[model samples]
Target: MLYRPKFDDLYRTYTRAFHLEVQDSYGVASENEQLQRFLGGEPTTYPEDWQQWDAFVKEVTDAGASIQRLRVVTEPHSDYTRFLLHHTDRNVAAGEYVRYLPRQNVSSDAYTVDDWWLFDDAVLAFSIFTPDGEWAGGAITEDPVLVGRCVEVRDQLWPLGIEFETYLRGQG
Candidate 1:
């Protein structure tokens, strides 16, 4: 969640990618809603200007990257829906190109937002997994099984949005 950019010494080198898995529980929901309320609808403006989601959307859109969203819920929806709807609006408001796919499935396990720290890329990616066990602490790679499991979960959801070039075309 932290980084140092580079060159102009602006510390914008936050080439971090984030991946997290979600589970059918209230833990993540409560925390996420709390965060939204705490930030007072400025979810994309926290931390700093570089942390601004507009910057992220611009970077990816200008470079022509794909944004795929996978839904793990069925008939009923969850709080995560807010993320999709709001961010989609965010992209359009900024005139950024973004393609999103919504899918339904059944996945096991939950994770903390901290799980997204594994991400680091120019085309920055986020693989979110709802973590178990009381939302673990800071980024800790000491546990590979948990890390590997998160990656495995993401692979299953990747195909839902494979046509990057084609997906970008639909974006304005």
Candidate 2:
């Protein structure tokens, strides 16, 4: 069996982490309640996981490390995506740099790449999800070829992403 390190472990060890998110909707079990609340017009509350993540981001960023996420989303936004957008300010405030890119702006070939996190531009952790968008598992690699490709992808897409605040304002 292959070893899968916890994300917290990875985050702590890496000074720079870049995340590429391509999903319009994610069926994360922990977010189901929050999603329902958002859909029902209830006030937002941070989940434990979200709080912990925010704290981690703050810690790393304050130490001079950086965490950035670029979400490539379809236009007309899925409900789940909207939910994420609504809460993105919290992430930004916690010191994460979040951005959004319209899927239409990218070549179709971009869709072939799975969501992943590149750590210190050396390690790649691919996030696996089931067809229904539920989290499945992760595949981590340090192969130079694969890591190099991911670095190339990041370089290509990073400039294309609009800051989260700017994108959200334009959505109105």
Candidate 3:
């Protein structure tokens, strides 16, 4: 059924975990420290939580599960995007395959919205967020039609995305 599982458990439970990110920014309360540090111009630190997340990614990937994310960002980028770019290195280091696609490059006619996670080509969890970027909840489902759509969307746009490092370098 549809349910919110622990982040680490996502990797453990599914053979493939795919995430699509459409937001220019997120105002998750848990990310406040990192955001503040980023805004303050402090050097990035690998905090304990960061390390744990990294470990989870590595463990999952090492165990042969794929963890991937596709982030669609607008060109000229938002401040939050820059912050996210800075932190993306950690995501890569942790063994997740991260990519970026410029908003202009993406054909809007193909997709209506963003922010969803697909697990094993079955479960789909559409994320909801406040206008201010605060984390809300997800609308989860397991309908085959929706699952097919998620797979199609992932296939169509994922290859068009630039790999994490390549995207950052191009931004410079």
Best by lDDT: 2
Residue-wise C-alpha lDDT for candidate 2, range 1-172, written one tens digit per residue: 1234375577778889999999788888888899999999999798777897798889889988889999999888899999999999989999999999999999957544588889999988898777767666668899999999889888998999999989989999
Q: Is candidate 2 or candidate 3 better by TM-score?
A: 2
Of candidates 2 and 1, the better by TM-score? 2
In model 2, which range of ten residues has the least summed lDDT? Answer: 1-10
Candidate 2 stretches with Cα past 4 Å from truth are: 1-5, 130-137
Q: Give the TM-score of candidate 1.
A: 0.40
Candidates ranked by TM-score: 2, 3, 1
**Residue 161 displacement (Å), model 2:** 0.2
Candidate 3 vs. true structure, TM-score: 0.86
lDDT of 3 by residue, 41-87 (tens): 98756556568778888888999999899999988988788888888
TM-score of each: 0.40, 0.90, 0.86
Q: How far in Å is the alpha carbon of 160 misplaced in model 1? A: 4.3
CA error at residue 69 for candidate 3, angstroms: 0.5
